[model samples]
Target chain A: MAITSDLRNVPLIGQAIQRLCSLAALSDIESHQIALCVVEAVNNAIVHAYDREAQHEVQVIFAQYSDRLIVQICDAGHAMDPKHLAPQTASPLDFDPCCLERIPERGLGLAIIRTTMDEVAYTTSHGKNILTLTRFLKSCQPGSARPEE
Target chain B: MQLDQRKAGDALIVTPLEDRLDARVATDFKERMIELIASGNTIIVLDLSKVEFIDSSGLGAIVSSLKRMGGRGELVVCGLRETTMTLFKLTRMDRVFQVFDSEQQAVSALSGNKG
Candidate 1:
């Protein structure tokens, strides 16, 4: 499914994720997680990928393998640096309850995507930034990565 | 992003009419919530029974709504599905807001009518 870079069309991603995950025999919970991750990717693409005036399009492709379901979100807006996706490490000594009070409500999109999807990979080629998220059908383990077949 | 609001024992019960609250309407949701706060109803109970899915933007909007309340009143959330609850827990927003199981419980807790 392809959608313009608008948040109003985000529901299509959920519908696609649900339909594809259902066909893959995923449980309701698993389906929901996949849908959430896809929604996050689409939202990121719509908000950050395109210029403020350009009407770029975002592409979502659903592929189901024997053991996993792969959803790829491709956008031509802006390429994302892989370094920003790396997990941040901070010292525990810097932690303060007051800091918790100041935690911004946003920026959890990437964390949610990483926590829900089994394997997440990003690549840019031919002026398109592709984010591939894979959810294993059989594994409930966190941070589990299966070699893509 | 329509919200159904009603008065219940000094607390305002606000329910979103949409099934999913995501980036599409997070800004509108925040605006309505702030409007509610401006109307002098500080104790608000958000009934999310109809909200099946909430993304980070939606969650952020709700957080900002809470912050808008500014310690004057309470913003209690109830009727969270397991998946939505997981999002709250994952983001640790569950600790920031007071969450209840049912709208009645939340209204009662905020209204000082625990019975």
Candidate 2:
């Protein structure tokens, strides 16, 4: 589904994330992480991509299979330079001083999304920036080594 | 969405913040803080146990509210979830505001202040 760049769209995106987590029957921590990722992604699209241009739309696609949940956020705004962004290493389960000191506002969203999901990839093509996040629901259990899919 | 207010002796307790404190709700949050300060509620404890997440705009709103309250009032935050706490630490807001692990601790600290 797609949503326009209205502030009202935030709750809708949040609700969608909740539904996805519910369907996956994720653990409490996992659910919260997913919710944060979804919110950050949608917020970035609205604040940076659309720049409050209500005429633009942020496209969200959710595809679920038996083992995985896939989410795609697509926008036609300016392509993002990933090199300037730093990855967030703060585990939701642990509080690290290094992670806490990095006060990154622009790149933290992408980093959190990357760390929480099983697989994260981004590409800019056709005047669009597409970010795809994949989570293997079955492999996310604690202490499980997720094999390459 | 609903804000519950009460007096814990000399300190005021505000609880159960609802809605995302982003650009949309920052204005309302600021207005409520200002109203509380104007009503002679000085030492304030904001129970943010219910706030799920906060953004930069929301962070700015809180800082602005603290400035508006001035030196007469103290704003202590309590019960921040991990995600919200991360935002605070990231912005160095943890240094700016005193944070407590529980509402009781926050209220007690405010009431115990000799100053």
Candidate 3:
């Protein structure tokens, strides 16, 4: 699924990912969580990689196997700094929840992805960047999930 | 980005009409809350009963609203879906704001605090 670097289209992409996750026999919570990870990755591509420029392209490719799901978000905008690829440990989640001022308002996207997805990898070459997320399916069976075309 | 609002004494109960309150409408949600607060609707009961999905951006917007309120007002959450609640717990935000099961309970808590 390809969408312009726009926030308005994120929910639609999330819904589609949720449906696909369900088809792979994931539970409702798992479906929602995985969908969220994909959404976060896509948001990174749009907001960071493309600098929120709607004219740029962000491509999301979903591949499901017997035991796992892999999603690759590709962008042609500015390559993300390698340090930002991995989620930060010092995030709003690490702070005392009661201390409102201690909690940061933003930068929760990548942290949520790291918390939810089993594996996260990013690669860039020749002005293109790709973020790959993989989640192993606990209840996956042969033929349950369709292979990528 | 429709919000169903009703006044329960000094508290305002705001329910998001949409099922998904992700990045798409998070900013708008925050701005609406700010608008209400600036207009003297201080004690807010954010009813999340209709929100089936919420992302990090949505969570950030909720936090921003709380920050906007500062110490002058209250921002309590109610009707968190199981999925959204899980996200709250993951971020430990469940401890920051008081959470209730329903709008009535939230309103009751606010009323009790005011008294």
What TM-score, computed on C-alpha atoms, does each candidate reach? 0.87, 0.68, 0.92
Model 1: how large is the Cα RMSD against the reference? 4.3
TM-score of model 2 vs. true structure: 0.68
Docking class of 1: medium
Clashing pairs in 3: none
Per residue, candidate 2 scores C-alpha lDDT tens digits across B8-99 of 88888887558467656767787888888898888888888888767555666677777777666788899898878876765556866799
Error of 1 at A71 (Å): 1.3
Per-residue CA lDDT of model 3 for B1-115, tens digit only, reads 8999999898999999999887878889989988988898789999999998888889999999998888688999999989999888877788888999999999998899889
Q: Note each model's CA RMSD in angstroms.
A: 4.3, 6.2, 2.0
- lDDT by residue for model 1 (A15-101), tens: 778767866678777788789889999999988887532467889988776667788999997887786566563322222323444
Chain B alone: TM-score in each candidate?
A: 0.95, 0.92, 0.97
Report DockQ per prediction, comma-separated.
0.54, 0.23, 0.70
Output the number of the lDDT-best candidate: 3
Off by over 4 Å in 1: A52-54, A89-100, A139-149, B113-115
Candidate 1 per-residue lDDT over residues B6-91, each given as its tens digit = 99988899999899989889999999999999989888899988999999999989988988888677888999999888788777
